[model samples]
Target: MLSESKKFRFAEDEEVTKKLFEEGDTDGDGLLTYEEALKAFSKYQRPFSREVFENYDTNHDGKLSQEEPETHSFRIINKYHFCGVFQFSNVVSLSHKQLRSISFFILAWQLLICDIMSVLVQFLLVIPQTFAGYSLYSHTFSYAIGSLDTLSYNGALMFALLLTINRLCIFLFPAIDQRVFGRPIIYGVVSLAWTLLFVFFIGLNATRCYKTFSVQGFYLHYENCENNSSSIGVIFQGIKDKWGRFSTYVMLGIYTLITIWLKFANRLHIKMNKTDGKQVRTNKKEIMFFVQSFIICITFLLESLMFDSIPRFKVYGQWRYAVNFTSNCITIFMFTVHSVVIFTFNSRIKEQLKEIFASKGKYYFASVTQTYPLQTTIVVRK
Candidate 1:
């Protein structure tokens, strides 16, 4: 289906492609040999296997090459593939340095989403509900907010843990990067998590929930009580004591340990890569990721620890409540900003941002160039 002028041609850097081709074809048979295959596999951060290489090389020319064995429309973002917005006709045209940068961005973006979810759930939904009665208008409002808070906090924490585990996996096993955390699995996990959250929290509330009503122009609240339920405020306090203090603290502890381990691992990674000057550029990224996690962990721990203290000392009626809310909001704000820090401080992300801008610039220049025309004018001189 190729036109005369629209033939498949190598549009990438020719020199780079030629060198890779030459190096890959080590057997002097005009094709890649098993040894060359091993080298290619090693370069891609995967273990070399002769059997796999032979199976992949369909030409039966006793040498391997970078031709597609299967006819597929979708590009695979596998170990041997880059699957970028741009394309190269040959492997040699691919820049390993740029590929690594993209890898870093992918990792950072995953972590950023988890942190954003954590902030949204913890600060906006959960923490506000911790107070005795932020939404005391009706039972429907109270139950709705309480259920949302529970779901958000727990779901966010679980998602954060998964993201941390995913980071560790990608860092250790670079070969199966796309396969390990592919789009299908990502979508499925997100859906399952949300579903579990709904069922878990909603089911719990369905059994031991309370309702508020107004009796004789006075507000009345009852929780699983048969006689004069409004007389006892113990139900609400019990709910708070169990879910607000104990459960939240448990989550905070787990997340803190995970964050600490992540920080240590990142530091150790930097130490190991001391000789690689390229890693120096990642220092800012490392610092930003570490600091953001540290802040979130500390904020969470502090907030969890202080949940009980705020109620014990009822120093200010309304003013104290305002200060408490403001402090909680600030912590949430830090967490939200933490989600975006990776994009801001990461060099790889910055590079991609520049590439996007440069691409737009090129488009505008091309448009202008096409519109303008060169003309020759005759100058009459005496």
Candidate 2:
């Protein structure tokens, strides 16, 4: 039942627990109100839903009294690794035509790989170093972790844009969709984009842009040029900081357009099979995939705001443990949710998962579904 939770409470310590309660208990009161707890959690970037808050406020009271902070378990990596790893594995083994025929799955597969690599490093090294204050780093560790951080964060934004564009073409501009996104073209687009992104960020490591980890702040910071705003670190950080909010707004605008297009699509005269008189429209399954992408995009929007709202609480000398736990919880959930949404929304992937596990890993049976996505064509009188 508890397999999914990454967090565990620290050992019982009244001294420390009382300090936590007092820290949360603003206005010099002994008990912490719901607002006090929420404000305190926001400072740490902790996930603070009403459900989570209610769980902490045991004893039927709406206040907290010195509860121990929660931290990551050793097995936390399993959550992301299993879902993402196996998703890729089945895709490769089965050679699923659903993914092979569509550009959306191509982008999603790349993003999944990025998430797996990012979470692997975070759970194994970053969590230990940040929370337990472990110094498990070689001289090369800085560049390596920094490269991963670059790939995951920056790579995700780019891939998400690709996915959004693919959806727009499928749902809104199907007339030029095939010419623009034929099998060879889409494959080339995603591969080249990822290659350039990888080469550019990893290439940065050759320069003076160094990423140093801070146990106090529990994140990596670039020391490429502290004083110069024109430094590599400063320049890169500025782009990342701005891209997230801008992309969110853009995606929202595009999604609105897509929604309107789909609503009025019946007004357009398009046909996949004019002989049989079948109506041409975006596939229902494709809409589900679009929904999944929407969830992830909205999540990134929230995550960006969380970071802005919760500046590093590095000054908490005695409350360092709570700070570590609360700050990392948000990150833990953020990466894990992508895979959860993927499996939950995509029926094809979910079915593939069931098949792989159902027969002890034998998966050669072909699906009876169509071998390819319907080539969207607009057949109307000029």
Candidate 3:
């Protein structure tokens, strides 16, 4: 009775309806409520209404439950965003490398995961809510995301320290490194890093509080209002900041000393033996490692400085929003640049990326050629 176009449209609508129903039934209890249906359909272009929901409740029940002859698909598709894909690729590339110590790789993985979380928080929470024409603000959400950003910054610093330490050990005391920084010891250090971060998070919750304030009836703003503004809190914050800066400087000094030592060591080796291919290769690797570490350390320090300089006093109106947005944008940009530097300086990552791209290109070219066969003309003499 229906035309072809009408039949196709009906099929498409049925498919979308089934998808919405499955997504709304989060508990898989074979039922959907008003609230669940609203949340599910709100993300889509359709306007969900109470009447529409009631229509789906064919049995006259308050809830929309699965009906007879309706088959539900329970399969869910998991996909990665840009940051997630990059994080996964970075981890995979690092894993393929044959390294004497995995401490650097482990720390790098932590940093990458932190950056991805930071990006996700901004894109999913901040951007969407800002653009959705919402006046309400949540201080807790802001603080949580800020804390995650700080954790990621600290992770970068720790990574730089780890790289410097590993290089120092290899160049200065190779024998002791094996026993001192064994797999178990390295694992313990990584665990300690995460444990300390967790403790710091707890401390932030206990010491600091965030509050929302109105700005001249123009807009609502959220800012940190330290609940414990006592000398103890100040001292604790100061100690934390000082420790981070001190550790970074110490690591940089150690790296410098190692560089000087390597320079002299190379000179002596050259004098003793004119040519050693293995030594040359090792030197090149060390050079690349040093460059990468240096750049990461600088970026980490700059980010720390930026956060430290952010005014604690309440900012109002567009200025407050502008400051916050700019700072977040800069932080994300720095994180991205750091990742690119790591990939650029590491030869192993370069080779892995090359292979990946090459294979993908070959597959794409093959598919295109197959889809559109090349036309060849045959010329015959008459």
Report lDDT per candidate.
0.44, 0.60, 0.57
Which window of ten consecutive residues has the lowest lDDT sum in model 1?
Answer: 71-80
lDDT of 3 at 135: 21
RMSD of 1: 31.3
Better of 1 and 2 by TM-score: 2
169-264, model 2: which lDDT tens digit per residue?
877687666766667887888788889776657555545565655433345556544444556656655555577677767877788888887677
Top of the candidates by TM-score: 2
TM-score of each: 0.40, 0.63, 0.60
Superposed model 3: Cα runs more than 4 Å off:
1-102, 129-137, 209-225, 229-236, 264-275, 306-330, 365-382
Top-scoring candidate (lDDT): 2
CA deviation > 4 Å runs, candidate 1: 1-146, 164-192, 208-288, 316-319, 331-335, 340-343, 347-382
* Candidate 3 CA-lDDT value: 0.57
Clashing pairs in 3: none
List model 1 lDDT by residue over 44-134, tens digit each.
Answer: 4544455444434434455654442321111111111222112111111222345333433333343344444443433333333322212
lDDT of 3 by residue, 1-382 (tens): 1111111010135677678778888989877888888888886755566754543443445676545111011000012235544755664455545543555565566666666765665454444443332223455665665566556555666656776777778678778666655687877777887887767656645567322222111112223434567775666565555766776677868878877886797677555255588877876776676676667666656656666676665553334444554554455565565567767766777777788789999898778766765511111221
Question: What does each candidate score in C-alpha RMSD?
Answer: 31.3, 14.1, 15.7
| Error at 270, model 2, angstroms | 8.7
lDDT at 9 for candidate 2?
Answer: 28
